[model samples]
Target: MNLKGVRTGIAAACAVVSLGAASSAAAQGQCSRDTLDDIAAKYVEGQKQGSIFTLPVGEWVDYRENGQLVSTATGVISQPSDFDWHLALVDTGTCHVLVHGVILKPVPYVVTTQLAWTFNGLGQIRSTVVREGDANFDAKKTYAYASKEDWSEIPAGKRDTRQALLALANAYLDRAGGGAADVALAPSCDRIDNGAYSTNCEPAPGAAFVDREFTVDEAKGAVAVVSNRGEAEGPQDSRIFRIEDGKIRHVHAVTPSQ
Candidate 1:
């Protein structure tokens, strides 16, 4: 998996390339969160059928697998696979959704995908990063843990601000890279990478990260950060966070096994 698309979502995604996720997201206020969820669900179904044409990839599409440009007509999405389960993050502010799936049939694989959509009735899939036997990866365990995780929507009044959420995300990355961050962690914070898991993590500054693009779901104190998108092959890296009361509750990731 090319972690380069890690930065791709925030930096060079389809429509967000020119306008940036922040600017364009405001202008595309008409983008429907429910629609995004529906599209993502469709993508999950499409993958099982080995058909990329199932989704509304409008006009011109820019598809990539592990940072290497791919001919959308014949790429990973065209290959049918069985997934144990999948997790989807809908970022209405950025008009992009991050889809993370774990496959357990034939050979096991974990895939992280990001899709860019516009109100013009066009949905463009910009990145599809696949990981096979990455570090600490155990597809079955991941599926089991994911099923128990609570990602329910945070009540509107109880939600953390986007800026706060973003900071927490950066902090997690910082700590991951061995830096000192001043973010809070819940008493029972959980961290999952591939299938290996940990608990009660500390926070740090995310400056160790570069070329980062963030997909934030303010409604749920969740953020998915994809960094180093410019690299074709590095680490298939991604960090997802859920924070409440300024303390991180969960951290999720997909990276190289070796």
Candidate 2:
């Protein structure tokens, strides 16, 4: 299946709106960096103690209850960004659980809604959460079997801090080129999102190509200033900031290429 076709529908617009809501919620929480750090530390501790069957989005947990060793419930550790966290309990004798939550960090930009883990007979953790998020914000909580191949898809090593920002720029370029389908490769992306631009651009397959040159500006937390020289449906030049994540968070256009 072409993931692009599915993603093209509202991925770009929703990403922007969701991010905005998240930012608003983060502001409302008034959670200081210290608070986030404390939470992170606590999560690490839970992992060390092996009590946390699964922790996703820097918060939230799913574990087996004591005694019966057949039921599971999810605990919310942080305020919801958009809506209250959702959980689905699965029964497999041992019980498998999934937790959904968001991680609102300055660096690693993550929005999780689906995370899975397994519990042992004694209600101890048997595995880590798999599939951190879903296409939509809905949480997927079920004890589905995960193959070895599933685990392999999990991202390894530290993510490129400049990815999200780069993606935003590339998204803009993709629109300028035509739509989401035009862009073949993942571009670096940062924070922020396209507004009207995101909606108007229809997904046109193989519309444009991007040749990017990046420089890390030390003064800006090693911010990546990207320049895109390419032809979408037409020629275009755009400047984008690269935030650390898998998707483009923000974008700006210097000259109209299409």
Best by lDDT: 1
Residue-by-residue lDDT tens digits, candidate 2, 1-258? 001111112234444543454355356544333333333343443433433322222122222211111222232222122212211222221122222222222211122111121111111221111122312211221211111001111133534433443455456555655574333222422221211233222234444545443332211212222223343223323232323334333332223222
Q: What is the C-alpha lDDT of each candidate?
A: 0.67, 0.28
Q: Cα miss at 17, model 1 (Å)?
A: 23
Cα TM-score of candidate 1: 0.78
lDDT of 1 by residue, 81-174 (tens): 7567877888877777888778887667777787776643234454535455455778788878876888878989999998889887876676
Name the candidate that leads on TM-score. 1
User: Could you tell me which 10 consecutive residues in candidate 1 have the lowest summed lDDT?
Assistant: 2-11
Those runs of model 2 whose alpha carbons end farther than 4 Å from true positions after fitting are 1-29, 52-128, 131-178, 181-258
Residue 75's lDDT in candidate 1: 69
Q: What global local distance difference test value does model 1 have?
A: 0.67
